[model samples]
Target chain A: MLSFYICLRKIPPMTEPRINPNVSVDCVIFSFEDDGLEVLLIERNAGQNRIEDDLLALPGNLIYEDETLDAAANRVLRELTGLKNIYLEQVYTFGDPARINKQKDQDWLHSIRAHPEARVITVAYTSLVKKSNFKISPSSFARQAMWVKVKEVPQLAFDHNALLEKALEYLKHKIYIEPLGYELLPERFTLAQLQKLYEAILDDHFDKRNFRRKVLRTSFIIPLNEKQKGVAHKPAGLYRFDKSKFHKI
Target chain B: MLSFYICLRKIPPMTEPRINPNVSVDCVIFSFEDDGLEVLLIERNAGQNRIEDDLLALPGNLIYEDETLDAAANRVLRELTGLKNIYLEQVYTFGDPARINKQKDQDWLHSIRAHPEARVITVAYTSLVKKSNFKISPSSFARQAMWVKVKEVPQLAFDHNALLEKALEYLKHKIYIEPLGYELLPERFTLAQLQKLYEAILDDHFDKRNFRRKVLRTSFIIPLNEKQKGVAHKPAGLYRFDKSKFHKI
Candidate 1:
């Protein structure tokens, strides 16, 4: 494997270098669908001429000389997908030297002008956004970017598969502490939808009675006067996520 | 303030650099004292034969080219304290660009030969260790390192004051999710001592009745058949932190 930085540095005229400068930012952008969770994956250089064209990866870029790691993560997501104003936070740093040592990974990096064997330490960030909130776009480095089902994703470019796994692991824990489950559901949602979202992400069935009892204790998941309709089954009561009560919960 | 790397890249020959590497690891080592939460503070290199003899800072260093950020953090802690096999985990990264702009911060960096004006993006890690389990030592960069009460700590070098606060904030949440409270207590501890530890760190009282009830729910805090003796007050029943039950909790 080669080394690379998951940075968002605005590379000035000095375009190519022999060794990797190392630090970069990589984003694992996640969204929820009716059936399961989804993550945004960027096709490896879709616009560029292809050698081994069957690769996909998380949206990432090298950190520039002056930009904050946070800024770099936001820029990478924005540039790759035209996504803006979404919730994103730094999750962890992936700094193993052997991360880019795979043959296909090396070939891909050579084509992109990154040192195939240089040590790259990526600052990985996880973002959960409403899929409808942003549109996808291609980059000079990535051919095309799209959101795919988390379970259905194929081998991603570089160490991104591991990155994706880590991101989800982080999300599972984050949703429990914060109200991330709300992000996956509609603005006005039924209690069933919220429970299903939790069950799906956690890969376990949450008892309906116990779930409601525990959730109500949080003081943030608010009940709205509205209710769900147009379903084959009878309509269910609706609820809204109260942002102001977040900290207190 | 002057920018620096939180790394330990055994500098081979290239001694001085004009620019900052941007990414490094900083360790905020914490231990529990009998009365309060204590944090490790390293006095700035007074042996450099220069100014600012009373300044204190966290134990941090720039990352070496080949080591992972995790390894760098551990090595920094080990090199400075001679401590090993202690609990350590990533807390957060402090990356505000203006962090190094203060005059005192910059002077200290110049004396150490790090980039005086470059931006340093630091990955901060927090470690909780038994003070008795390890002995404190100094590195080339620190004059002496010692544990200071978290509340009594004055202004620290660079952004370390902010770093220490963040570590404690992280600790508050971590103790609940995991059995970190046990690290601060003896093998067998009284309910009053346990409540005091919680109160001291959160700076708020946990009602005695509510605390005992709530703590009983956590499988990790086990009731011991022993009691505290030779105390000024009543000898309270003792409890133990069960490591085996950590995952279950």
Candidate 2:
């Protein structure tokens, strides 16, 4: 929207608190819903003066002089989408000098940044959240923040596509070793639902019997007495993640 | 030791290629030697006018404007310790606004850096090397680089002690899932030697029989037709890592 640019331009450069143009933080906030893995993205709407094409990107911004990288990531996510109190883990820092050298990205940067020529090295953070819990409200320069399916993510702004791939790889690897898969599921869940979550994240199909056998072997996934209440089919038993048990091992 | 300062001071600031003072790279290079897990550290000898106690820290320096983070890490490692062609993976980025806010660190920075007050966000890298393979010749401002046992590492410059701790945790976690331990061993090693390496890194004793049984279950460690020679103790059968088998899994 034109309002996004107008709002940014209204803030005089001299009056703004000094930001480290060379250092920024981008967050890949992922959620599992609609039978798939989805990532939060902000649509970069440059209005009428847009060059090349508009694109989507992770919620990100430069760190202020006094903020830590973690604080900056949380602040950026909150400022762009009004989402806060989410646990984010820093995954990687992409610091290629030519990361933002593409003409289209440079144009987008010029529209949004005061120092477009500064080499921005971004520290990327990834977090998983339940999609049903929070309402998406676009704020700051982001006019639209949406959860797009990971498989359907298009060509994003800057090096975001690459960042997304890295985040996905991290998520897939972490899901196997850590109890991170539970973040995307209900407090109590079925093995079928768990399989679907893994299939979405790993993009690989597993034999239902084998998947259950392997997962049940882990001490963290505790079987529960509860079952799916409203489903038409036979009710499957539920399971919950045993956080204390996981830590003990 | 004054030569270290003189060497740094010799580089005229104006003619120097612009460096990102706010971003740097540090390396935690680990090696298995002397019956313990060792880390490569450089002595920070701030000559005559030293305001604080001398410290040993990870090999690191600010990145140049044209380099990628990986390249900067390699450059920093090579420049500081005269070691090259080592594979380093980015583990974490330490970017607390107050990371280098300590008076001791500030004093040391004043003696070495052009912009000592810049909030440096260091991207830390970790690597494993065979201590017997390469000789370490301290270069740049580092007058003394040594392989100090991880257990004996002293208080470090900047936030390096915390960085080292994170790197150690990463190493401990990674050694379980990945074939990284091979990097710290010879081409052919005894099972006893392998167990010792694990004990040193994990800092826990494993029952000899159980450790052997667990490791032998893995397909990657191929039994070789070789054995230790000329030792006072009984000759132990040697085994080598199967790179192809490891990759296939």
Q: Number of the top candidate by DockQ?
A: 2
Q: What digit string (tens of lDDT, one per residue) describes model 2 on residues B2-40?
A: 999999898878666788888999999999984798899
TM-score of chain B of each: 0.84, 0.89
Candidate 2 chain B, run of 10 with poorest lDDT = B45-54
Scored against the native two-chain complex, candidate 1 gets a DockQ of 0.39
Tell me how candidate 2 scores on lDDT: 0.88
Give lDDT tens digits, candidate 2, residues A15-97: 56689988999999999985798999997656556554477889998999888899999999998998889999999999989
**What DockQ does candidate 2 have relative to the true complex?**
0.76
Weakest 10 consecutive residues, lDDT, candidate 1 chain B?
Answer: B1-10
TM-score of each: 0.84, 0.88
lDDT of 1 by residue, A27-56 (tens): 998888878889998877623558665678
Q: Quote the lDDT for A126 in model 1.
A: 91
Interface RMSD of each: 1.9, 0.6
**DockQ per candidate, 2 decimals:** 0.39, 0.76
Chain A TM-scores, candidates in order: 0.86, 0.87
- lDDT per residue for candidate 1 within B88-144, as digits (tens), equals 788887777678778887887777755556567788899777687778877777778
